[model samples]
Target: MTRYYRALRLQMQPCGISNHAAAWVTTSRLRLTLPTSTSTPPRLQACRNSRSISSIALNRTNPPESASTRSKDGRQQQNGTCAIRPANREFSTPSKVGRIYDPKMAKLWADTPMSLISETGYKERSDIPPGHFAITAAQNMAHLHNVIIRGFNASYNQCLAVKPDTVDASDFLFYNQGLYKSIKSHHDVEEDITFPSLVKLTGVQDIMDKNIQEHKDFDHGLELFRTFVFETDPKSYDGKKLQEIMDIMFPILHTHLVGEIGTLLDLAKYDSKKLEEWWADTSKKARGDLDVFQDAPLMLGCIDSTFRLDGDPRPFPPIPAPIKYLSKYVLEWRYSGRWRFNPCDTFGKPRPLAFPNPGGSKL
Candidate 1:
């Protein structure tokens, strides 16, 4: 075992992943103590290493296709079907094809016919009059919810698109886990941090009472859906059963997601300064605490970089360019295969679905 680990470390080093970083990912679940280093913190080191290894793993695993498999548009053709192009093909270029927000992908991006939450008629921060923060908060809330909804629909539609026999269950399940974890993590923060903070901030003890109850409305069904996806063996996976479970809960969940936007908008009645403080603090906590391995990638992969807001492109999330670049080039490689199911690419541009509906189902 010692010799094998040494060999693994040697191989990983060429990819620019340090020995300590490799250990962090391979034994992530296990607690380990190492001599403290001044260079980088443990968590950051883990993230950097995971990114390097993921890209190396992807490149090593997916070999170049033969000239015969190349299509006129430069995508690979396999068994007469257009195969998902390699992640590296358009690594430095924005995709000119595939639009996640298009009418064809309505189920993924739209809450109602022709209505996208990202482009919804919410007042901008600058447009708000002095001290009025409700509309800004609501827009931010809507943006976050829209991403989550897109991820859920992406996973749901992918399951529906491919035949069960042909689907890669591991990739599907991991992607589902990312979506599941993202939603659960966000709600957990709300229940544990945001809700209580809001009650104190507004002096309305039950400001989020309806939302809390609504969370209960679909909690069991969501749990069942999560269990069905993760616990079920790949060979025994039943697509129909998965759809049935989602059908029972997702409508209720979607209603809650949309309704929460209204809830934020209604905060106009509260003190604007207090509301702004709550949003600022809570948003920081939420962003800082995301699971870098899963939730971060899931969120980044759902955003639409080209989807402008108030004529400003890439305005959502409000992350800096350096972090965004790291996220796209490095962190995203952590779940490179799982992200294949996401509606948008790592940089948030819409791309062709890795798994498309075989019968051309209008779902």
Candidate 2:
């Protein structure tokens, strides 16, 4: 049967004409036989003259009276409406509803004016201590925290649209590694270098203990993130599952950063030397431990988890107090060349801090 079919196909081919011309002849024959009552004679003539065999074949395959052609004609039948077919196989039409603005809502905030609060009322009255170096260090650490947080938030939110499974495996690995290194190094520096140096500079040993405990809390959150990355399939991330992980970790991170900032502020008030020592140690650790490649993965994991509330999309909460402090601190460190010491005067304009005063002012 196959042999007979092949012979019949060979016999169907034109004797001297090429396959292209044969196809044109076959299509033209088909076009001549199509019913002419439905379409205008001009369209039929135009189809006959179109040189491309494929065009004629298409016209014959989707005859003018077919459902699809009728649908297209129906759309054209509508006055002043353009039928747009998308590449994704969806059809769309222009909206007729005009934009409506709520005047009451618009007017509510329109009459209210904004003004910068005066710095005069909020100045710290403490005398500048002789060991200016320590004061600067505390300020620098504050800055570093700010930068890291901002980088984390920006990178994380950018990746939300990325399917967890679809994320580059290399990037995921890098992000996790960077996160571990950054957290571990920060903890190590506080325990071994920053805390000890602060003790020597300020003669206050209790502060060091408190800082160590804070580091331990942060380490707990880091441990949770590490476990999630290792256990969860990146590609199959369930929003709820990711959110559960985030809920457990963000508060810990927030608390740890806020505690550190509060401690630094206290140090700044008393012994600037200790603050300077702490900043130097932390910077040294951060530079050595943080891996840029790993940041993205860590951030993705963190954000995916944090933003997963009730498995529904919601506005990301305001930047945590610790992150804000860290951002400001890092910005200062970048702008000012001093890695170990940042003078209070350099914190020129009063800015928001995680720690708010009784009167609602940021410390």
State the C-alpha lDDT per candidate. 0.60, 0.35
Error of 1 at 254 (Å): 1.0
lDDT of 1 by residue, 1-363 (tens): 333333433332322233454453344342333323323356765764565456556553434589977866665543312233533223233222222244434233222211345433445434445447887776666667767777876766667554454437677877887777777767877887778888888788988999999999989998998898779776776766776777787778887887888787777777788888887666444422334456556776787666544334543565434344444455666666677787776556676566654543234
Write candidate 2's Cα lDDT for 180-292 as tens digits.
45556556656665567667767877866876776666666677666755666766654334335445655666566545654654554554554554554443332232211
Best by TM-score: 1
lDDT of the structure predicted as candidate 1: 0.60
Each model's RMSD to truth, in Å? 10.7, 26.4
The TM-scores, one per candidate, come to 0.68, 0.41
- C-alpha RMSD between model 1 and the true structure: 10.7
List runs of model 2 lying over 4 Å from the truth: 1-122, 125-131, 155-160, 168-173, 268-363
Which one is best on lDDT? Answer: 1
